[model samples]
Target: MPPSGGSPVEPPSGSEGGVMLSDVMGRDRSINLFAGFLRDIETAFRRLEDSSQNTTVLAPLNSAVEKLPRKPWEDPQDYGALGPNAYEGGEGRERAQQNLRKFVEAHMVPLSPWAEGEKVRPIGGDRELWWEERDGAKLIQPDAIEVVGIAGEVANGQVWIIKGVCHLT
Candidate 1:
């Protein structure tokens, strides 16, 4: 488990080692860090919309903003459709996809129905995810959106990094 700032808080003596203090803190920090990244992504989306130059990479970002089901909720297909067009070359496409995956993962909001008690799965399938709690707040980690060797990256005002990847069901 990663350190969660400041001095480490040693566990109380004589307690069962069911869960480590570091684990809990790491989860909490991961959630907060991801949330901050999501906030930045939302702003980036807005800037993409405001831009006038219509580039290939801008297309997917625009579509994502338009098709985002709701605030903090988005479908993975939106990123898939953008494909290589989201980036300039092979490397660019990979970066774009990585970025988009990061954006969605960071921004993914827990559905009330699912968050109530049930274990939530990824939109497409059983992709491993990270769950974190910070100050009693919960956060979900984003899944990797990739096709082959290409990864996604966030560039400029758009989530313009991707390769023709599929999220296996």
Candidate 2:
């Protein structure tokens, strides 16, 4: 876990031998929307379980997810269709899954202890992201979402609770 001032709480004594990313997010109420989303995406969950690679999860707060202009699975191509259930059946189901995967992956950085200004390709997409500190807050960029604090420090990496949504598709 990060130092106490920038982290919600001190990491549990067993952090190094310890909790997984899923457990961390699942237990944190502030990021339940993202935690729920993580559960629904199996591949993303698998990535979280892969301790061989370092990963940092930039989970958006529930309020941040709620304030999004559109749901995570939505794409403008879906707008070409009629109803809200655009990603509901047949090929749409596959499309929905793909869209959802990208949304979750966008929040995941492939590196842990990610440097403050070093840009890196995300674990799942073409878009690269970096961090910037404006005043005292560390923000993920391209989107400039504010990272509120470290939610958990585990063996694999850290989970950051953020204040804004990332990719929509």
Cα lDDT of all candidates, in order? 0.31, 0.75
Give one digit per residue, the lDDT tens place, for model 1 in 101-125.
4444432222312222244543333
Best by TM-score: 2
Clash pairs, candidate 2, are none
Window of ten residues with lowest summed lDDT in model 2: 1-10
- Can you give the lDDT of residue 82 in candidate 2? 44
TM-scores vs. true structure, each candidate: 0.23, 0.82
Supply every candidate's count of residue pairs whose N, Cα or C atoms clash at under 3 angstroms: 21, 0
List residue ranges in candidate 1 displaced over 4 A: 1-32, 43-110, 113-117, 123-125, 128-169
Task: Provide C-alpha RMSD values for all models, in order.
Answer: 18.4, 8.3
By summed lDDT, the worst window of 10 consecutive residues in model 1 runs over 147-156
lDDT of 2 by residue, 1-169 (tens): 1011111222234333456665576778999878766766776776666656678998999999888877777777777774766766566666776777788888888888888899987777787788999999898888888999999987778899999977632
